[model samples]
Target: MPKKDNFDEARLAEAIKIALAQKKPNIAKIAREFDVSRTTLSDRVKKAITPTTPTESRRNALTSYQERALVAWIHQMCNWNLPPTRQDRQVGKNWAYSFMARIPAHINLAPVKQKTKELRRI
Candidate 1:
């Protein structure tokens, strides 16, 4: 079966830009314009598209700002007496470190299951 996400990845911002420039944005119409699912377009907008695809380099690993934010969030959770479970820590580490290097540009969210699958292959 063909991959569900087979379209060009580099043009997502363009599509999003086109969608938002409308005076009265319509998700369905924007999706048709970009040849992507409406839900996909909606998600990108909601995320503000900070995080993007993953890569293999480590130079841009985690910026100091991002690291501090993550660590602070983790510590905050602890202060709340609602410490994250093992899985949450794993996710945090995976994202905070260079494992997310492969992600596309400006994408803040990580696909945990997909990362797990990649880890297994490595």
Candidate 2:
């Protein structure tokens, strides 16, 4: 199981800034002042660990551009009545579904048809 981060990223960034601004930086003091983890602040100040935003995934096999391209390809294949084969996809089995969930407006694998205006009268 992964440990949840109790500290806010913004607070950590602020702490790193304060620590770096000082002539003789006290990581522990800055961390305590900003309510961030001492070790994390120290690591960031020392450039020991690279900072990553919340949306950045370390284990992603494809970039966002690549994912969008794959979605476009899937849409194109469906339009041509030639659904992609399993061997055609290089991504994991769940990647397509997950990608759709992430950005539903971009591509919908299965869109339901709405009733016509005449059908509403019945």
Model 2 global lDDT (CA atoms, 0 to 1):
0.71
Expressed as tens digits, the lDDT of each residue in 48-105 for candidate 1 is 6466766634554456667556556655665655543334342445553443454344
Clashes of 1: 17
Per-residue CA lDDT of model 2 for 6-122, tens digit only, reads: 768888877877777787898888878987777777778878335655686646667778777877887777776565644665768897567667777635577434445587588
Task: Score each candidate by Cα lDDT.
Answer: 0.59, 0.71
Best by TM-score: 2
Give per-residue lDDT, candidate 1, residue 76.
62
Instruction: Please identify model 2 stretches exceeding 4 Å from their true place.
Output: 1-15, 31-37, 44-66, 88-96, 99-104, 111-122
The lDDT leader among the candidates is 2
